[model samples]
Target: MSDTPCRVAVCWLLPELEQPARDLAARLQLPVATADSIEAELLLRLGGDGLSLQATGADAPGAVRVDFVEGALAHRRQFGGGAGQMVAKAVGLRGAVRPTVLDATAGLGRDAFVLASLGCEVTLIERQPIIAALLEDGLQRAREAGGEVAEIAERMTLIQGDAITFMAQWAAAAPQVIHLDPMFPHREKSALVKKEMRLFRPLAGDDLDAPALLAAAWALASHRVAVKRPRKAPSIDGPPPSAQLSGQSSRYDIYGKKKLG
Candidate 1:
């Protein structure tokens, strides 16, 4: 993704959220308008479902929203394999050791949420303003929902800044684990990719600095750095992972800095 901040505007379909939308517009230094009038590449939509993104184009799909409490995240929390899952194991979540994790990429905050649900304190870093806003709104609504999901959301922190810069400044206070899930160029057809990916790819672009991100993670993580990759994709360009943990559709390339206690 580009290091430069993304340009976006706040749009509202529901009348009740207009003031809040205006407030966000002011904070983001963007204009407030309806989706149809939005001139920016990304439109932040405040609707009943929550904060979503609407890409401006002739062939763009409908607004895509982030819902932590009621969709895939909730399903995973309810029925996912918990600490036994691949990502959990990759982050060294075994026994009573719940390592603090910094998710460098934090796209949509899915893996971060999973780690948080498994009892890790996860700090999520998303550089893109639009994605960060959506993640922030999702976390807030999840917190207000007030249940297990809310409790999990409590352990998750969202940081709106470049991960590489954040890690560079975090050398002394590095977390036990740093997770990287940089977006790769999608080779599949647009119809084949997930809706969220379709929407996000246009906004975030390919993560061209992924190798640099890994290097920064190595410098910051006290214990290990775990990278998520498509099962069939090649390893990120850098030193080889110390080990790997694989699932059906994805794999975790683990670079060990120190063993987890």
Candidate 2:
């Protein structure tokens, strides 16, 4: 089916956020409202705190927002193994070589931000408009925060579009690593499924084209392609991965094209 999030509306909670809300409403062809309580399954809310995707209904999941300066991301940046985390090693982050990365399935940009915080220039492509908008807001806030957060945010560039076409037609400086975290069915009992994903599943729908995404990543990355999968999940339908780095809950399957310094 369509690979876009459904039932999205644009709204503003602050006067300063009104212009951007209206602008996004016009671009996305969605209704604009001052209150998020308006009739809509999902709301793209703009406020002084930044953009957040909120869901309605009594049992709705918690709101999804990107905040690089605090919360889980901050804790991970501080405590998670630097350049030694499974993802770091999977992307070929050796002593002197922190390869530039292109994250093709940047849903909320957590991994990409991690790579950036470690010194890799990262370009993110999020196909879903709602998620992309949230990422952009987070990046903007990070930039305004200054210091290391700003530096890290500066390393990230968000490009909202279909990554398959983007990789195929790319003519700019090609990234050394292409990362794929295509959506997979979240096992009900698995701790890997976050609340944000509860809302994301309904918006992003099923990821029926992950195989194609993997193929695109394979053809484009100069050094390697890394696919993040659940530890016990089956591999994508394609060439076998050259190597695998496993963590407690997730797996990184690396398809090497060439060696990175």
Compare the candidates by lDDT and give the number of the best one: 2
Runs of candidate 2 exceeding 4 Å displacement: 1-5, 34-38, 186-193
Error of 1 at 193 (Å): 1.4
- The 10-residue segment of model 2 with minimum total lDDT is 1-10
Among these predicted structures, which one has the highest TM-score?
Answer: 2
Q: Give each model's clash number.
A: 0, 0
State model 2's lDDT. Answer: 0.88
Global local distance difference test of model 1: 0.86
lDDT of 1 at 211: 92
Candidate 1, residues 154-244: lDDT per residue as tens digits?
Answer: 9999999989999888735679999999887767543345767767776788888899999999988999999998888889899999999
* lDDT, model 1, position 108: 90
lDDT (Cα, 0-100) at 250 in candidate 1? 86
